[model samples]
Structure formats: structure tokens, C-alpha cells
Target: MYVAAKGGEKAIANAHRFLAEKRRGNPQLPEMSVEQIREQLGLAVDRVMAEGSLYDRNLAALAVKQAQGDLVEAAFLLRAYRTTLPRFSPSPVVDTGSMRVLRRISAAYKDLPGGQVLGPTYDYSHRLLDFSLMEPEAFAANVVYLVDKMIALPSRIPRLTEIVGSDDLVETPQEEPDQDPPVPDITEEPLEFPASRSARLQALARGDEGFLLGLAYSAQRGFGFQGHPFVGEIRMGYVPVEVELPGEDVKVRIGSILVTECTMLSRAEETGGCPFGFVQGYGLVFGANERKAMAMALVDRALRSRELGEEVRYPAQDEEYVLRHCDNVESSGFVQHLKLPHYVDFQAELVHVRRRDVKKSQGADDQGPSSVGSAGEG
Candidate 1:
């Protein structure tokens, strides 16, 4: 009689059609081009790049659109896309020290040979919202440009960390790590004892931005206080990528991508070392994620005492504490699982509790005369 509710399917199709139309908006109006999304929605793109662990801006922008502006979802999409792509060979490491940096700032030494240059940061910007963006035409400001400083950045190719041994400015290496696959692919392999920093950072880089922020916040609020962190360097720019020729000593440029690399030069607290020991904290992410990079750096330094021959006392100092919980898929699923229905079990528990309480009350009521006897007996 009510049309047998037959329009539900039609209604769903109509709703989807409406949503597509709404997402596109008026045909006469300026269509939201991927270029527009890339330029205007850059923060979203940056976030995607950071957690996605890939640096393609256009694809990141498209992900932002497909995700309906949800940055985390966009990042997940980007990462998913990256996972299915083919792998040819490992790329040659780019030297960050020689990098043509766009933004470089060092905290360890204010007047170090290369001075601090903050390029395109919202660090000092006022937190006020601009409603004038409502029209979208009133936003215009002068853009600045400058060039300076260089610091070496180790690449992922040949396990280059061996090139510069532990905190020692100079150390003799037995030999370079032979060209081969990374030792751990936690994505495919299970995590085991004595986790590597490379594996830890690999997980952290693709971790949930907000969760990392919270963990980093914990360190700042004194959950684990060792030393103050200075923005040693945060560089955002393209670096030439390379692929080594298999069975040959030659290396070729594969492509270039934007990245944010942060190195925190902080003083180690006097736990077991001299009053202060200089330590380095490193963070490398896909896009210009200064905050995440800086946070990761701080956490990185805190976790180094174990390797530095000092006792690891704090939770932040535990490699397992930091790395085990950094994954987005793992963490979010666990936290959100609490929202699943448990009401049926809860109701049974409630009924049992009420019955026990009523029986106890009835017994107590029957002991009314006993209450009077207790006063006299006392």
C-alpha cells in the first residue's frame, strides 16, 4: 500500500547522484581542479605525504579530494596506492648536507657557520581565523625567497649510517654495508627483539599524526624529561633520487620528491654521562611536516640512552613503548573497538548485581530484631 517501499534502491542511487553533484558543485562555477586542490589544500597534501610515505603532490591532492578532505583518510589512500606499486631497485642516498635547502634552522648553535633561516613556516603566525576566505578572492600576501647553508643527509640505500659511526665525529668503519634489502620489513615481517631505529622511524613516519603529537606532547609535559630540544634543522625541498645499476657500480636518478628532514641537536641530561652530552635526534618524513619531524626528533634522542650505555628509565626511553604503538591502523582499530556493542552482556551483569543486592537487603530486613539485639548485646 505504501508503494512496497520499492523506492529505497532508487533513493540510494539518487542520494549518491546528489552527493556527486554536490561534490562537483555548480557546473557554471569554477570546478575544483586537482591543481587548485594541490595549491589551496596543500596542508592536506603534506599530511598525506607525511603518513603516506610517498611524495607525489598531485596524487596526494587527488587523495584529499577522494577522501572528502579527511587528511588521515587521504594519507591512508596514498599509502594503499603506494603499497601496490612495483619496486625495481633501491635508490642512491641523497646527501642532505649538500642539499639546496629551502628552510634551514639550527638550535644547537645560533651562530653556527650557517645561520637559521625559517622559510614558509606558520610558527609565528597568529592563531586568528580569517573569515574573509569566505569569498576566497581576498587572500594575497607577499612571498619571500632566500638561499643558504648545507648539511649532509643520509639516504636509505646502502645503510649509510655505518658511514658515520655512533656519535663519534670520526670513526673507522670495517667496511660499507653491502648493497642489499633492508634488514627488517615490519610491514611484511613480525617485529622481534632489539628493534632497529630504522624500523622504528619507518613506523613512526607513517604513523597517525595526532597520536604522534600526543606521545610527543607527553615528553614535553615531563613524562620523560631529559633535555630541551632545539630545531637543529628542518628542510623542505626536492632531492634527486637514484637507483643503483644491478650488477654494476653505476647509479641513476630515478626521480625527485619533496621531503621534510628534521635533526634535533639536544644536550643529553647528566644521568650517567658528563653533566651534558651532545646528542642528535633525527626525523625524516615525506612532506613539510616540521612539527612531526621535530617531535620525532625529541623522542628519538630520549630513546638513545640505552644505546649510549646509560640506563633507560622512562617509558619514552623504551624502544618498544614508542615503536609498538606508532601504527595508525593498529592503534585506531584497538581504540575504536571499544565502541562495539556489549550491552547484552552488560544487561545480564546488571540483573545479577541487582538480584544479589535485593537478597542481601531482604536478609538485613529480617535481621531488624537482630539490630535491636546488637544494641543490647553491645
Candidate 2:
């Protein structure tokens, strides 16, 4: 039975049905709404949105349900669905400076222009499980808040890069090293090494949360955290994406997207023949995942030096190392699906090993009874 070819078609159907049944256990009980999952199980949805690069809480909730609460699988579902949606023109470059922040914190400064706002986060929540929620709630409750909008930002829109650009005090870029960038399509194109910073980030934006976190942790644990990453700022909110139209001269707001952007500081280091300069580590993910984004930023910076002719000495410093490992769909599918039949290759290996053993034994026999004193390692 184990050697027989899999009835893959039937097995797939049966497995799918089993999964659906498990997702909706006890159909007789009142159906759980997507909104309930979105509101109650928000952290899962947040991770999915962060990794999937979409902010539709409803779709994320459904994905979680379909994935049976497996965050990685849920992220994959969201990513698949997001890819299927039509692409509108990008909204005008929504400035992070102008973000309506849901959560904002800065390790750089305790008090900055925008006083840190820890808008919505579970980081402060205790991990203890609650058992009383098995029973239904009597009623929904409302929360209160004080409203203040963009009070920290200057009304006059100043160049953001200009403010930070001068701090380097070294050989500077002729201009913004990253200008109007051409975005790459990850779903359609195979990931290539020495990918542009933009492509690297897009891949990270859609990478697995656990995977990214692990890579980030490895670096911090002495794998490659040579340059201690300082969280310049971790801001979570929506940014407008602008796209030019066929006949329009002015770029218009195509749509808004939630993104977590991280900027890491690297000390000046001379590489190859170039003089030292402040290396900027940047990371951008779909939603509010500051940790993942921050980790991605570190990895991104590490990868950049390779293309810049800097010698790579650390695993995390290698672009291929981080980007190749962060993709869960590719890794998980490839690993788990190995359980499927590949007996042909195994049989060939088995036959080759047996023949080699037989030949070795014959070689021993050729030595005659003297082999009793000349035993050899296989």
C-alpha cells in the first residue's frame, strides 16, 4: 500500500473536505461571522496582513478560518487572494510623515516632533489565557478615546530626505539613491540574486512572519548583527499610492495601503574602494508589522553591501540567505510535499548502493581467505 502510486485526485478532494469540516465544526451551532474573527482574533489577522501585504480584515479572517488558525497558511491564502485582485493605479506616494498612525513608537527619541503614539497594540497584553469566554457575552461594549490629528507634523510639507540627508557628513549620494523606482512583480517573476532594494523589500513584505522573525533573531543572536540596529522609528498606518494615468499630467490617489516601514542605522564602513558612508537599512511590509519590517530592514542593508562590492562575512548579510528563506509558501510546500511519491529516484539509489556493496564483497572474495586479516571500512 505504501509503495502504490497515490490516488492523488481523490485524496486531495477528501483532504479538502476534511479541512472544510474542521474549519466549520458543528454546523448546527450558530455560524461564526468573519467580523467576529477579525475583531477578536486581531493579532492573527494583523500578522496575515503584515505578511500578505493586504489590510482587508474580512478576507484575512476568512483566510485564518480556512487555514485552521495556521498563521503561515493564512498568510499564503491572503497573498493568493490579493494577487487575484485587480491592480488600480498606485495612490500618490502617501507620505509616512502624514500617516494617520494606529501605532507609532521610536527608540531613537523619547520625545520627538510626533510624540510617540502606541495606538493599538497587544504587546502590553498578558499572555495568560482566558477560560471564561466559553460562554456568550451579554452585550457588546464601546470604548472611548480623545481625537487629535497630525498635531506633530508641520503644516508645510518639507522634503523628508533633505532633513536626514545632511547627517551623514561623508561622501554623499549625488542625489536620492532611490528615486522614482520601478516596482517588480514577485508573483510573475522568479526571484533573482542581487535583486534591487525595491524587489527585496516587496519579497519581504509578502514573506512569512515567523520566518522573518527567526532570521532577524538569528542576526541579533550573533549570526550577523555586527551593526546593532536602532529602530529609527516603527510606524504603522495607511499610505496613499499614486499612479499616473494615460492622459493625466498630475498623479492621482489610486488607493491607500497599510504599511509598516522600518529604517535601521549602520555606521560608516569602508568597503572595496569606496569611502565610508551611513548605510540606510529600509524595510516595508504590507501592514503594521514593525518587528518584521525592522528585521527586513537589517537584512536589506546587509544584502545591499554585497551588490556594492562589499565582502559578505555573515549569513544574514547575504541577500540570498535572507530572501530565499523568508518565503514560507515556497519552503513549506517544497518541504511538506516531499512526502508524496518519488520512489523512482529512491529505487535507483537503492539499486546503485546494492551493486556497490556486491562489488566490494567480490573485491574482498578476490583477496581469498587472507581477507580474514584485512577487513576494510565500507
Candidate 3:
């Protein structure tokens, strides 16, 4: 028989109140506004949006405030809120090649057609902390950007993959000529093992940044494919999202959203009289999350072991392992559930341990006197 513990309702309510109070510390200080979070803590907001699978910047900022800056909690809140929204229509696939060029770079080539533009990156910045940020004016002054002249960028930037493919040095991504399959939505259906490329990409898009980064590092450290990978191109900009109306021949542009896209190329084995060429792995995520996009591309390539005829010896290469464990919501729930009261379960385990110990004690007593007497006689 088991008994359950009771009387936590009031305590739980009080705990939530306490949390809220702590979250809004130093009430004398100006309250942090959602707009400030969206604009100032923009990177954090971007991460929450990417991991939550929600694209609303304002909502993500609100979640960040509500969660007291805990990114995982913020993402969880956003994901919960996303479920309540009504589904209207599915958006058409975005075209990355047509993205309004903000930042574009390619490690594979010296200079691409549009030229490498290093726009607003911390890549070469000094690591020393600037304590002057304690003053609001100093922070504002540091971030001021003055564009003296307006220069027209090319309408379209040619992809490095196309450049490499032109000389037959790399295999360009191509769809089957006879069939055009609709991409499966992971949110609509439960993720199955041996998931489609669409499902895999969806999972990687929302996966925890640190987890994906670690796996990508592991793959690079020889746990998986050891091919030298070159970042073909990384682009960050806004692209128009379009949706097709039911029973309509036309698709209308809904809006524009910022995104980061990465294309990674690796050497592929030459066979069947074909020249040695490169294979590509692609990643795209909301906002300017370069690390996430790069990690995603690496993991995406690692997960394609079966299709690419490579041995699946690494954890990243296992489709079931990656997809099943990548969701932050599911992982965080299981981990945080440890805080829930487990009195009944613990009590049952305690009783079982006591009973087993008593039996052991009784058996020891039964053999004790005879063993002691035999030892004394010897």
C-alpha cells in the first residue's frame, strides 16, 4: 500500500509569488521594459526564438523578462504560448539566395561575386571587458554607426557551391527530376526513426545550442567523419516569407524576417570514374546565430551517414539518438521534474530497503553462534 503527500497548493502559490518578487528586484530602479530586452538583449532574444521555434521578437522578449533571463525557461514559455496560436496557413519555402545582403562571407573562396561583407560581427573583437558600459551614455556612444554614403549592393549573390560545382569540383544539391516531394512537418507528426531530411533540419533548427555545438566538436574530433570541411558561405539577412492561399494560383509575401544561413562543404570520395568532389550540408536559423547555424550544418552532415554510405559509429551519426534527445522542451521537463515531491515513491523504496536489511540481519544471527563456537574451538 502507498500513501500520497498533500497540502502543497498554498506553498506552491507562495513559491510562485516569491519567484515573481525576486524576478523584479530593486523596485526603486527603473523597470526593464520589453522593448529594451528586444533591442538591447537582442542576441538572447534571438536564441530564445531559435530554440522555441517561434519567430516573434516581442513575445520572445516578454518570455525573457518573465523567465528572469533564463534562456531555457524563456524558450519554454514561448513554446507554450506558440501552441495557443491559431494555425492559418503554411508558409512557402524561403529562398536563401535572394536574401537582402546584410553580412556575407565564404571561407572556400578568396572573394565571391558580391564580395565578402563582414557586417556587425564580434569575430575580431578584443575579449577584454569594457567596464565603461556601466555608464549608459558610454554604451550608446560605442554602438553608434554612421553610414557616410549609400552604396548599392548586387541584387543577388551567387552561392559558392555553384562556383565550386561549375568546375565539377563539388556536387550541387539537386532534387529528383521526376518527383517533387512535399517536406514533412515535424510539428504536425511525431518524429519517427530514420527521419526525413526535412524533419532532421527542423529538429536541428530548434536544438539546444550548446548540445549541438558539443556534438559538432565531437564530430570534428574524429568521432564521426574526419573530412576537412570548409564553410562555403555564411549569410545573414532578411528574406520575405510567402504563403499560398487555398485554391489560389498565386502566393503572397506575408512579411520579412532575419535569418542566418550556412553552407558547409566536405570532400567526397571519388568512385566509378567520377572526379573527387565536395558534398554539402546546409543550415538555416532565425536571426544572426552564426554558431548555431555552423553547428547545425556539421551535425546535419554527420546525421546523413546512411544516405551517404558512411559507417555510423558516432552518436551524432545516429538519427534516432540525435532527434530523440535534441528537443530542449522535452529534455528540460524531465530534468526539472526532479524538483517535484516524490514522498510516496521514496517511502516505498525505504520500506523495501528496511525489509531486505532485516532479513539479512536475521540470517546473519542464525549463523553467528555456530560460526563463533567453531572458531573458539579451533
lDDT of candidates 1 onward, in order: 0.69, 0.70, 0.85
Q: Could you tell me every candidate's TM-score relative to the true structure? A: 0.75, 0.81, 0.89
Per-residue accuracy of model 2 over 82-170 as CA lDDT, tens digit each: 87888755555457766656666767556645566787777788988755445445222333344555345433222223244455442
TM-score computed on alpha carbons, candidate 3: 0.89
Candidate achieving higher TM-score, 1 or 2: 2
Q: After superposition, how far is residue 351 of candidate 1 from its true place, in Å?
A: 7.2
Highest TM-score model number: 3
Give the winner by lDDT: 1 or 3: 3
C-alpha lDDT (0 to 100) for residue 372 of candidate 1: 69
Q: Please give the distance, in angstroms, between residue 340's alpha carbon in candidate 3 and its true position after superposition.
A: 1.2
lDDT of 3 at 211: 89
Q: How many Å off is the CA of 77 in candidate 1?
A: 1.7
Q: Per-residue lDDT tens digits of candidate 1, residues 1-378?
A: 011223479887988788788777779987788899999877778888877777789999998887778776677678778888887776765665555555666654465444455677887889799676665555543322332443443332121232234565322223656775565766667776577876777777887777677766776666664556666556776667888988999988877767778776655555555333456677888767778887787777667767766667677777887777777656655666556566898999999999999999999888898796998899
Model 3, span 236-271: residue lDDT tens? 998889999988988999899999999988765343
lDDT, model 2: 0.70
